[model samples]
Structures are given as structure tokens and as C-alpha cells.
Target: MDQKKEIKKTNDQIINSFSTELQTKVKTSISIIEEAVARYGYEGLSLSYNGGKDCLIILDLIHSIATGILPTNLTNPEKLKEIVLFYLRDEDDFEEIDEFVNTSLRSYDFRNYTKFATNSLKQGLIYILKEYPKLQGIFLGTRTADLKGRKQPIFAPTNGDWPESIRISPIMEWNYSDIWDYLLTKKVSYCELYDQGYTSLGLKSQTKQNPLLKQKNGEFLPAWVLSQKSSERDGRILSLSNSSTSTQIH
Candidate 1:
């Protein structure tokens, strides 16, 4: 099928597939992206994508609205050259994760994707700011329940000591169930780690299959079925089950 026709079909499907609650969240998130574009222009915006489930949903949301939201210069945001994309590359990253990122950049036609060599999220942000001086905002795939997510506003600003840039948490209001519902209902592509019971992905050494999901047959369940929402990170070696803050940022 032609690119134009395919986009139209997918957009219609996306609108009809999600539940009413999820549709509302999707609309608000897209509106946030639109607001960011209005404030900084498309070229001045960026996205922090790491081939994870949360970020994958963010990417698909952008793709869903690309034909209408983005300028005509790129034909479609699927060309993905107008707005820069940043990935914090790490030495300890899972090979599967890296492969997914590489495949997605190609499949999405992300012509402006850049990778930072460091593992620290703080350091990666610093690197991107130094590399792209004109950037005014970067879309983050944050949700209401993530670490410090409940405390921050939708358009959270960087810390006083860090480089200044608008952190656009478009899906800040979405919850854990909403995340899974959007991904599965929309038929969106996601990383394979989730199906293997790694509910919260961290470094390869630190992350494991969630024991909460372990079955009597010595198999584990999918990430979405883990009953206790707070135990999502229990698979991690440094899981802070007792603390309110997240021990590791996926």
C-alpha cells in the first residue's frame, strides 16, 4: 500500500481501538506534543527513545499524528528527520534491547537519531544539550506511577544544576494498566523483554524475571499480569520494595 493510504488506515484504527479512558489519555498526550511544537517548532523538539514499552508507545503516538501534526517539509514525521532523537547507549545494555533500537530507527525512518556513549541518564542529557544548542524540549515517556513522576508537573523543567530544557511528559497521567492497554489494544510493537517476565528492565546483570509472576510449572508470566503494581521492579537486584522512590529508571 502507498504510504499515505497506510497512515490513514492506521490512524483510523488507533482512534477506534482504544477504550474511552485510554482515548482521552491519547488525545491529551498528542495535545501536549502539539503544544510543544507550537512553543519550540518541530526542529527544536526532541525525543528520548530507548526501545522500551513506554517509549515505544510514545513513538507510535507521534507516528499516529505525524501526517497532520508535523510540517509538510518532511512529508511525514515518519521520515523522522525534523525532530532529533536521543538514546543513552550503555555498555551493560541487553543485546536484544540494542537490536530493537536499531531495528526501530530503521523501521521508523528516524534520520536524526543520535546515541550517547554513557549509561548515566544525567550525563546523557548533558551530552545532548551540549550537542544540540538550539533544542528547547525533549519528550519523555513518563507516567504517573514512575519514579518521581507523581511529584513532577507534566512539563517538568530540568533541575537547577542540570542543563535547561523542557521535559515534556505527554503521558504523565497514564497508569500502568493504561500503558499495557494502549500497547496491546493498539497492536503497537514493543520490546520482547516484557513477555519474558522482566517487568522492569535495568542493566542485564541486575534485572531478572519477576518472581511474583512465577508459576508452579517453573515458568513466568508476562509483565502486564503481575498483580501487585508496586512489585513491578521486584525482579531487579537492587529493588527498593520498601521505599517509595524507584530504585532504577528503565
Candidate 2:
């Protein structure tokens, strides 16, 4: 199948797999996004994607909503064409994540709308906003369980000289299990690092296979195999400490 057809098929499958309750939540989220698009115009909005599972879910939601499959009253189909996507490529990023991002861009036909930069996320956003002065909002995949994500509202206005844009977190209420369920049920492809036990991803120097999922034969299980939410970030933290120690020794 062609890329567009494959993308539509995947989105249709995701919409079909939504449970009744999830369907309601998804509709509400779509409405929120549609309203934002209407108020700000697509040219004034952007998506902050990090090639993570949560961001992938948000992308799916946006696609479904924009294609009129989520039961929203949004009428501007062309609006989707104007909203740009930004990805911050860390210097030490995992190669698997980079591959996944490239695949997703082709599958979703976002090659023209996506921008990638190796600088800090803040700097990248600043550059984009400067290029498009009308940009007033950015959609994010931040969940409440994340450290800086706790207590974030669905729509948050920024302060200071950083861009005068609103931060939108549509999936802030979702948990780790909710994300996994949606991704698995939708048959969406994710970064290969997850299958190698990297639950919470970061730079390669700050991420490692989850020790809890390590087998006696020395093979590591997938991140989804972890039974506890508290252990999700264990591998990242451990890797950070290891890197710190190595730096001190050198």
C-alpha cells in the first residue's frame, strides 16, 4: 500500500479500537484541539514531538481529528497542512529513535511540515516562532506522571521572554498503562529501544536497558514487561549515575 493509504488504514484501526470511554475522552480532546486551531489558525500552532510513545499517541489523535474520524465539528481540513512539527534531536540520542522518527514522518506524510534541530528545545522553538510570528500555541505530549508535567493544565500560557505562546497538553491525564494499551491496540510502530528494555528514553549516554527486565541468559525484555510504574525510569537513572561515575574516573 502507498504511504497515505497505510496511514489512513492505521488511523482507522486506531479509531475502531477505541473503547466507549476512551472514545468519549478522545472526542473531547479532539474538540479541544479543534477549538485551538480555530482560535489560533493552523499557522499559529505547532506540535512539539520528541519521537516518544506519548508523542506518537498525540500524533495519532491529531491525525484522527483532522481527518474527521473523531466526530468533531471541525471544518477546516486544510488547517492540518499549516501546523508545523518540531523535533529536538539531542546530541546523544538513540539511533533507534531517529529511525522511528524518520519512518513516522514518511508514514504520516509530514516531511514538509516537520522541522528538526540539534539545539536545545527552547532555542529551536524560539527560532520557529521567529520565523512564524503568528505562532501562538504548541501542543505537547506531556503526561502528569512526568516530573515537570505534574499539575499542568490542558492549556497553559507561558511567561517571560521565551515565546508568547500557550502550551497545550491534551494527554496530560493519561498514565503509562493507558499509553501502552492505546499503542498496542492500535498496532502502531514505536522506537525499537522500547523492545530492548529502555522504558523511559533519554540520550544514549543517559539511558540503559531496564535491569528488572534482564533475563538469566543476559537478554533484556521489552519495557512493557515491567509490572510497576515506579520502575519506568529506573534504567535512565541508573545510566545517568554510571555516566557520572565514568566521567569522574576519567
Candidate 3:
């Protein structure tokens, strides 16, 4: 099979793997995305990709939609040619995460769509917006359980004083387990940190293996084994506390 046909086959497998119930939800999310793209055009939309589990799910969803696995009103092939993918690269990011992001971009044929900024999230976003003023929307992978994500709508309009871009959270209703299920079922490659007990990812200095996942047999469990969604960020907070004390002592 040719590369294009192989890619399409992979996407079809992923989309078909979803349960009937999940498929319904996926369709709804895709519809929301299609509407947004229709309203602003593909050039006017961006995907906020962070190389995290949630963002990975969003990435796959977009791929499925673009390949026509999920329904979409977009008919122009040119609109899909240069769909912008934005990433804010922190200096303290994990090496594994960086590697995964690069590998996935190529593996998923998204190398041409990526835009990287080595600055703080806010600054990176501002820079991108300034560079691409036509961009009016960003597709985020924020779930309701994430920090400051509870109130975000599936199609949130931008604040008047903000960057003048809508923040779209199609998977806002999805939970922790939902994310893992989708990724694993789709045979998606994720950051290696998850296998090392890191439930949630952040700057390397502010993230660590989840202590709760340590077993009495001196073995570590994968992040997806985590039962509580709220505790996913415990490692991050613990790391921050340690960093703060180390700073004070110096």
C-alpha cells in the first residue's frame, strides 16, 4: 500500500475502535470543530498541542476528522494543507516529552503544520497570534478536571482583553480514564514518562513520578493505572514544593 493509503487505513482503524457511545461523542466534538473551522477558515484556526495525553487525543481526533473518518463540512483540500499547530516549548521540559512530540509530528505527517516557540506559554501565544493575525481560534485538549478547565466551554469565545482568539475544548467533558482508553485503543504512542509513573506532565522541575504508584514490590505502575483523576497532579505539586524550599535555602 502507498503511504497515503496506509495513513488512511490507520485512521480508519482508530475511528472504528471507538465504542458506539464514544463514537457519538466523537462525532459531536468533530461537528463543533467543523463549525469552528467553517466560521474562521482553516488558516484562521490553530491547534494548541502540548504533547500531553489530552492533547494527543485531540490530535488524533483532528486527524480522523481531516481524513473524513468523522463527518465534516469542510470540502476544500487547500484549507487542510496548512492547518497550524502551535506548541510552547519550556526550557525545563522533559527530554522524553520533546522526543515524543518530534517523533509524533513526523509519524503523523504533521511536520509542516508545527510552529514552536521557546518561551512562556502566554508569551508564545502572543507571539503566534501576532505573527498570524488571521488565526482566530485554538483547539485545546483541556478537560474539565484540569486546572482552570472546569468552566471552559466546548467553544469558548475569546475575552475582549485577551488574544482575540476563541479557545475550543472539544473534550472538556472527557475524564482521565477516557483519555487513556482512547490513546491505548488507537495504539497511539505517548510520552515515555507515563510508563515511569508520571500521571501528569509539566516542566521537568515541577513534575515527577507519582509516589502513589510505587508498589511494595519496589515496582512502579504506569500513570494510566491511577484511579483518582484529582491525584494526577500530586507529583507536580510535590515537585514545586521541593523546588521552593531549595530556592529558599540558597
lDDT of 3: 0.70
Please provide TM-scores, in order, for all candidate models, with all chains considered together. Answer: 0.85, 0.82, 0.82
Looking at model 2, which ten-residue stretch has the lowest summed lDDT? 241-250
Model 1 clashing residue pairs (backbone):
none
Report clash pairs, candidate 2: none
For model 2, how does the per-residue alpha-carbon lDDT over 128-204 read when each residue is reduced to its tens digit?
A: 78777788888877666663334557888866665568888787777677777777876778888888877888777
Model 3 scores a TM of: 0.82
Quote model 2's TM-score: 0.82
| Best candidate (score: lDDT) | 1
lDDT of 1 by residue, 1-25 (tens): 9986776676656666778898788
Query: Candidate 3: minimum summed lDDT over ten consecutive residues — where?
Result: 241-250
What is the alpha-carbon lDDT for the whole of candidate 1?
A: 0.74
lDDT of 3 by residue, 1-250 (tens): 9976876777557667887767666767777777878778888888777788887887877776666554456676335536788777766778787788788887767634545546344455577888788888888776676634236577777664556678787887777777787878777889888998988887776677788899998778999999987777777744333321121000
